[model samples]
Target: MLDSNETIVAIASPTTPAMRGIVRMSGQSVVPILEAVGIKSSQAKRAQVIQSRIDLGTPLGKLDIAVSLWPTSQSYTGQPSAELHTIGSAPVLQSIVNVLTTAGARAARPGEFTMRAFLAGRLDLPQAEAVLGVIEAEQRGSLEHALNQLAGNLSRPLEQMRSEMLDLLADVEAGLDFVDEDIEFISDEALVERLSVIHAAVDKTRQSMESRGGNRSRAIVAFRGNPNAGKSHLINALVGREVAIVADVAGTTRDVVSVETTLDGHAVQWVDTAGIESRAQHDPLFEITAASQAHALRASQNADVRIWCVDACHDDLAAQRRYFETHDGSSKRSSIDIWVATKSDLIDSTQRQPDWMYTSVITGDGVDRLRDRVSQFVASHDKEEVGSIMGTAARCSGSLAHAATCIETAIRFVQQGDGHEFVASELRVAVECLGEVTGAVYTDDILDRVFGRFCIGK
Candidate 1:
């Protein structure tokens, strides 16, 4: 558990010198801190503002500041919070923070204020993450998504579903407790009906997370293939720099690494992900390898364009033909897939697939053609709507996907005339999964992952 009893202080505005900067404070001691700085406690009441000066003594003299106060526990952190706005000089801000700390305030940790708001029930998990998203957003579309999420556009439905599931679970468990009595707490048909609805809602949310591409302002071009297919070299060649590590060994890239550049006037982010390999998660030897494969798969799915890099010297053309014939580029209508024969310098023209693009980073062959193809794809979809999901939504996707599966299993149990206890167990897991999405249920690890990325003073 986190302690919220101590007074915390931080510089809330940008550190760059400007006309004004704000040093924010939260906790029961905020009023006392103001008094120590020479501002009257009474003057710093809720919604009240005071023009004041803090005497730093010696060379710095007294600095003019504006104080905005919420003397009661109803501020952003659900505590008595105040903001001291003064000239945005770096030294002045530091001096003010020093004054507050000496008086009674401790410097706040990164995202501590927002985390306190979450712990106090002022904002749910999704809303708290959205606050960070708003702070870090670089493009207009990302900002819009973050704002909408902050407004409860996504959490509202999930919260509603969780509530309904709780009611259904109560009914199902009640039926088990009264098996000897002549009362039907819940009908089998009703149980299935409610679970079906929950399943549908989970599936809808999952699809949105999966379909949302990264950063609409720039196109995501992902390189994917089996191990040692020259993906790293190709990305280096395209960017004209050594962004990804190149090696002759398999599985050199275990995580997704990307570089941003302009391709024929179109902004693009080229991603080099781990090689797609067969590995069993249950095996201790392949556990980490399997994780890397999963990361690669997710990157490819979110990409706007997948560049399939096939090793020209080693891969069998017949198998490649079969794979491409059956698989579509992507489920997303806007996404495209282009096959490329990599390391073309090592193979003869007769050995390469006629329809596929050929490229060799060593000899600089066909790199420009590959660039032009990706640029064309980006231009065609320039006007398409982007920003399908907030980045934070990625976390909820797994939870919601699991909830959907659990609900489906519960539905099956009900239909098959399984014991009420078995049905209740499935519903319990399903409810917990939904709870994780909205933060009705959470662990310390979840909190750390969500808030650790925030900049201090947010």
Candidate 2:
């Protein structure tokens, strides 16, 4: 379906200094450009040659180039395509693209190249989405998932389901047309069975689409305790950076400090909140504002894990216990509350605290153990993958929901002993809902929204 009217060109490389850069061009003009640049070759076939300088007579100077060409049928967009590999200098790359544009090629729009591939039937919507996934992926797990989708892992199952739905629809239409026929083309029992299979398949896909990795979960980890509890020091130690302001004075951390980091391939947001206190009058007016402090307290209460960072050198152990005892008890059980004693270097070698580790954020003592415990908590709560299922997009999810409603109506019609025609009408509506998911009967708006998320040069 590629339009023959326009030619597209783009710099198919990251906008950073690298060893090599490529300027890709596709359409009818590619062959003429290759021939003009002294890289003489047949326009009927694809060819590539290294270090072949294409001298373009321009105002700047004669241009030196390397060229490769793919014939119309074999090219990515089903049009004549070429790639000019040059030194990794931005100026050289820009000069070549400028020369091509002057000769007659418009700069490719964002995602236009990939969009052409989709229109040309080279890729389906899911595979097209995977192209973007491969580009933006940062983790190994995410990269594997994207690669699997690109290889048509999800598409095969979706296509099977679509085929089943189409077969059922065709049977229903045939039954309606031959109303007087005695032959049972599609029995009531068979119709119910087909609908059940379709519903089950769609439901499975919906479940798979739910969040998988630890980073997708909204759980947070908060550091809390009395003033000078080494909260700031612990934050820096965990992230291996000096992100929070560390000071010897108490109440130094009056505001919440947060940072995002990955732990065991799971994304986590670490928060350091102001120390909780009993005396309200002594606190500053800004701290007293219910909205601000309440927000922090709520976050702490809802956190997946709350580390009560305590100072090991302090002698008032019982007082600290009493202080936390007076506060609300609901949060204590819900959150994984662990007592952490910082500055283990200052404590006596013989003395030990019960159910507590000797942690020195400064010396990096027992920090690895702490990180291991956090990783364990995340892994235990993550969902397991059983049967293979496709991750549903927002549009697919909405379509499934609509189809479910239509199926419910069909079920009611069957139970009420409505005429076969009425029951068939509701089933047709159900089939349409399913069709929308696979782009069989999609609106223009749906198509635009799906493809619009892609990058221009894709």
Clashing pairs counted in every model: 0, 5
Weakest 10 consecutive residues, lDDT, candidate 1?
382-391
Native-to-model Cα distance after best TM-score fit, residue 167 in candidate 2, in Å: 0.2
- The candidate maximizing TM-score is 1
User: In candidate 2, residue 396 scores what lDDT?
Assistant: 65
Clash pairs detected, candidate 1:
none
lDDT of each: 0.82, 0.68
Candidate 1 C-alpha lDDT tens digits along 231-304? 99999988988999999999899988988988776678999998876766577749788787777777787788
TM-score of 1: 0.63
Off by over 4 Å in 1: 43-45, 213-390
Candidate 2 lDDT over 70-101, as tens digits, reads 75657677777888887776777777777778
Give TM-scores for every candidate, taking all chains together and pairing residue i with residue i.
Answer: 0.63, 0.60
TM-score of 2: 0.60
